[model samples]
Target: MSKAPFLLGAAFVAIVTGLSSIFIVDERDQVLVLQFGQVKQEVTEPGLGFKLPFIQDVVSYEDRILGLQTQPLEVTLSDNRRLIVDAFARWRIDNLIDFREAVGAGGVDAAQARLGSVVSAAIREILGSVPLNAVTSDDRTALMNRIRDIAGREAASLGVEVIDLRLTRTDLPDQNLAATFARMRAERQREAADEIARGNEAASRVRAAADRSVVEVTSDAKRQAEVIRGEADAKRNAIYADAFGKDPEFFAFTRSLTAYERALKSGNSSIVMSPDSEFFDYLRDAQGPQQQ
Candidate 1:
């Protein structure tokens, strides 16, 4: 029984040592073997890996791309404008050995901190040299490329590859937003007033043109009417002259009768004259007057 217990204890120890000697490297992971806190080997490939039992330990880092979001930063533009900018980055560990050497025991967390600093510096440097309009324009793509290049160069020492860095949001500070909006509104109002004034001017021109057309038409009608009236008067005078030539006594009689009707029309009218006046000659004799 004593021998049996010793054999069982030895078997248990061997099984534990066997299990501890092997480690697994996943496809998504890069591993470093550390012995007594010193890097002994790097296991970059997936599958079974061997390490000294109990004395060695494996540390792993992500092999795939990673994302990071930076806090909003206030940047001063070349034109002395201030804006709040928020950015994000896509990056990956390009060299595991250099990354381990740079970060030491701090690992991914330390690397991220250093990389974020580089990005911030790059943002400030590039943005400070440009005006606010350029930052907000479509030309920002070139500016962003410049920032990425600067940051990428600096981050190379930290063993991180910056694939891309982009500004996710850019806005005026809270204190400036209301003022900017008010100014824009004022500008729009001014433009509207100008348009309204131009419209009024055009309307006045249209009204003046219509008035001139009406005056021209009325004057033409009046002129034509005057011409027609003159023609009618001429015709009436011709008719009277022809009648007088045909019968002088009859024509004089008809004219005297028309004059008597006007002088005696039904109204409160009176005329004082001598009874034997020439104006009453027709009334005294229906034959008008003795022929001259």
Candidate 2:
């Protein structure tokens, strides 16, 4: 019983020592073996790793890409437009030894802080010199590439590789939004007014053209009617002249009857005249001016 207890205790101590002297290196992590605050070794590949128990320490950093989100920053453009820019970046530890050297015992938090500073500075530098439209235009792709390049170069010193820089939201400030909307509405109203004016002008021209055409058509119709009436009057006068020449006495008698009928049309319509007036000659005798 005594030997059994001693053997079990020895086995437990050995297992504990074995576990303390060894560490696992996962694929997602970069391992650094440090001896008394000094980097002694780095393990980039995944597998078993070892360090002196109670003397050396191990620190791990993410080898794969990590993310950092920056706070919203207000940037002023060349045209004096204000924009609130929110951005994020992808970064990873490219050199474990250098990362330890640069950040000391600060680890990922320190590295992220460094990245944030550099990225923010880069954003301010690039967007500050350009116009608002440039940042929001098709050239946005190129601008983001420039930002990543500049930030990546800056982050390299801290053993971090900046994979990409992403701008999440770029917009005008709250105070400027109302002004921009007002300008847009004003522009639209102006355009509408111009279109209405043009339409009115076109409509007036059409109306004027129609009025002129109506006047021309009415004048032409009146001229044709006058010509036709004159022709008909001439024909009637020629017929009358022909009948008068063929029979002078009969024609005069009939014409005198027609005049008498018109002059004495009704009994209520009276005219005072002499009994031997020439007007009564036709009524008194149709054969001659004197009674037979």
Candidate 3:
């Protein structure tokens, strides 16, 4: 019965020793085993691990990407405009020994803190060099790339690799928005006014051209009418001159007959006669021939 108790006690001690020595590391984790406060072994693969009981310590760090998001920062640009910027970064522990030496077992959190400061400083430096419009629109991507390059180098000394850095949001301060809108509105209004002035100038030119056309048309019509009247007058004068040149005595007799007919047709009557008058010669000749 005493031997049984001793065997049970030995089995308990062995169990304790086995439990203390055995450990497990997952695929996504790395563990550093320290002996007497010095690093003894590093288990980087997924498998069962062994260590000295009560004399070794294991520190585990994530072997996957970690994320760090920063609070929104109000930054001033070279143009003296304030902007709120929010950014984030992804990183991972590259050197476990160096990471542990520099910080502690809390590798990801410590790296995040250090990298956050570097990113903030880099952001300030880059953003402060650019104008507000450049930061908001023009070279934002390039600026971020340069910042990431600088931040990556800074983070390397902390035993971390900065995978990516991104801008989440960029905004103008509330106080500046109204002023920006007003300026935009004024610019648009000026453009509209310029267009209107151009339109009016074009319309005036068109109206002047139309007036000139009307004047030209009227002048052409008047010149043509004068030419036609002059042609008609020349034709009438030629006809009259030909008739008068052919028989001057007959032309005078016809003219005298037309004048006597117009005078007899009037309501008032007057007579003046002589036997030897040329007007009576035609009547006298007719009567004498009948008498003979």
Off by over 4 Å in 3: 210-292
Return the number of clashes found in candidate 2. 0
Model 2, global lDDT: 0.89
What is the lDDT for 284 in model 2? 77
Residue 193 error for model 3, in Å?
2.2
TM-score attained by model 1: 0.82
Alpha-carbon runs more than 4 Å astray in model 1: 1-7, 231-254, 261-272
Global lDDT of each candidate: 0.91, 0.89, 0.84
Whole-model alpha-carbon lDDT for candidate 3: 0.84
If the candidates were sorted by their lDDT against the true structure, best first, what order would they fall in?
1, 2, 3
Q: What's model 1's lDDT at 90?
A: 92
What would the C-alpha RMSD of candidate 3 be, to one decimal place?
Answer: 7.1
Error of 1 at 59 (Å): 1.4
Q: Where does the lowest 10-residue lDDT sum fall in candidate 3?
A: 283-292
Ranking by TM-score: 1, 2, 3
